[model samples]
Target chain A: MSTSTTLEEPKTGTWDGGNEPLKASYGKLMMWFFLLSDAFTFAAFLIVYGLSRHSHLPYTGSPEEFQFSTEWWPIPEKVFNAFPGFHGVDLPLAFVALMTMILILSSVTMVLAVEAGHRMDKNDVQKWLLWTILFGGTFLGCQAWEWTHFIVGTEEGMLLADGTRIFGANMTMNQYGPPLFANLFFFITGFHGFHVTVGWILLVIAFISTVNGVYHKRGHYEMVEKIGLYWHFVDLVWVFVFTFFYLI
Target chain B: MAAHSDHSNEFQQTGEIPKAQTKVIWKTFFILVALTAVEFLFAFTMDAGTLRNAIFIILTVFKAFYIVAEFMHLKHETKALIWSIILPMALVMWLMVALISEGSYYFDSIRNYFN
Candidate 1:
């Protein structure tokens, strides 16, 4: 049998001219994708934390005979109650609020740096980038102090029945109601801190590059914009972490 | 090449000094600060319960939206890009819902079985 040969016109799919559908640079688009994926990672951690908190056995007995019961979970306000230099004071969430402001201010400085980059004003870009770095470093210092306070377990930590002092935070145990609670705290906050540190290094690099007139040579300050995205994403993740881990 | 030189000249003329963005940036900073302050206030005042937690989640989402829109320039980007990020996030939310419900069931079973 002879088959009828039909030459059909090929249908064209979506047109992508290698142009950014978002009008963003390839770098920025990729940065956004990375951040979105990072967000899911953070979400998984926080959701598990919430689930653990929901199922945790709260400490109901006295300090000396501290025991975990399924009845209650340790209050976040009670756990994170200590403040810097106020050794005996229970300033719940005050220092953390300050930390939040520091991150916000750093984000502001980062945007200012990007704004200066847009103007191609190298001096302002360098100045603002340096300020952003300073703020990030300060925030990191505060986090270090917080971790030290948490690990030292001066007043908040409790002794368990097995004679294991739930001092500081590790993967195994915590003075907090449940080991999972502190584990999530350390992991989530540490992950976020790592991001902040990376962003700070990137900022420093961007500062040097700006000083060296790299973007000036490239005819645009898009590198600054890209780094700003990363920095702001760090701050953005911290917002969620603060809400779930500290505020809630 | 003449084309390469023209491209550089065009880029030079396009990006003018953006003073307006600085003002917008400061405004966003203050809004974030104020929202954080409000969160702290609520944390201190409101009783630790579901309602307070819901409000915190709402406020956090709002802050996240503002940061992404203004700082990340998502507001100026195309709808396709915005939805690409947001729609995938909805899937994350679904995962959260599914996993959290599963966790609740597990907790109930453990509590009922052991206690």
Candidate 2:
């Protein structure tokens, strides 16, 4: 699945051969299968998230008068209110909304690049892939910044089950409502961030290949389409992540 | 026409985007943006409840489907390929519902056992 299909199609043959089974090339069919398994992995993670979320009581306190309780899940809007430029502003969902927009935009560029590849237009592929890589990189950078703030903890801090004041999040403890809440945040978003980083590297390599006429030499640009599939899945996963972690 | 743009010969390399296709792509982008904005509006204005959670999950699923169908070209693929991917996801979604519904029971049992 990592490499592109190098064999040219058997132009107009009686048997479609093993290569074109199910009306898709071997590479594409394999990519879809891989994506299905990946989807299962994510679904399992998120289902666990949902379970952990419902096990705890809801945070009944007002966001303005927010206080963490060991028995309730953290109110996300209360916990994730810190925006980049503004201090002490009650701007919940602002930064995450921006992150989601950036990722969705990158997915668009990736689709454009794939569209260009289908046309065998090398220059357009290069251009759109450049934009996709830029957006992906920016998203990774934003995630890094968000993680930094999350680790450093809020200024007011949170009360633990022990009645001790703690700052940022760690494995066993956090200022957030449940240690599980913060733990899931790290695992889910960190896992997605790792995907974005890998996809960005792949996009850069794909960009370089577009520039060097690698696909042109091979007489097809199916590689871009394959990578586009991966890139879009990354974007799709983030949509779920943003919904689960930030919004609700 | 979109078909011509899709199958333009190797000699036609002006780096021009397919106009109709670009329109569709931008339209999808705006739809996603609008959906996110609505989620934001709800986040700020409405208090969180089962209703809000349902709306968010439904909207998120819609966005996810749109991306897979359009961006990943799953809609363009054959029906066999499509169902093979979606059916299992449907089952997984069912599992999600089943497990989450049992969560309160799990919590109760664990609390009882511990106490």
DockQ scores for all predicted structures: 0.50, 0.43
Return model 2's CA RMSD, one decimal.
8.6
Cα misplacement distance, residue A56 of candidate 1 (Å): 1.9
lDDT per residue (tens digit) for residues B1-115 in model 2: 5656533255444665444257778888888888988888887788778899889988998898789888887898888789999999889978888988888788888778857
Which window of ten consecutive residues has the lowest lDDT sum in model 1 chain A? Answer: A62-71
> Candidate 1: which pairs clash?
A58-A72
Residue-level lDDT for A140 in candidate 1 = 98
How well does candidate 2 score on lDDT at residue A106? 98
Worst 10-residue lDDT window for candidate 2 chain A reads A13-22
lDDT tens per residue, model 2, A36-109: 99889888888889899878777776667768655789888778888988987878778888899999999999
Which CAPRI level is candidate 2?
A: acceptable
lDDT values for all models: 0.81, 0.85
lDDT string for model 1 (B47-114, tens) is 66789989999989889988999988798888888899999998988887887777777778888995
What lDDT tens digits, residue by residue, belong to model 1 across residues A25-109?
A: 7898899999889998999998898777656554545433433321466666766778877888867888888899999999989
Model 1 Cα shift for residue A174 (angstroms) = 1.2
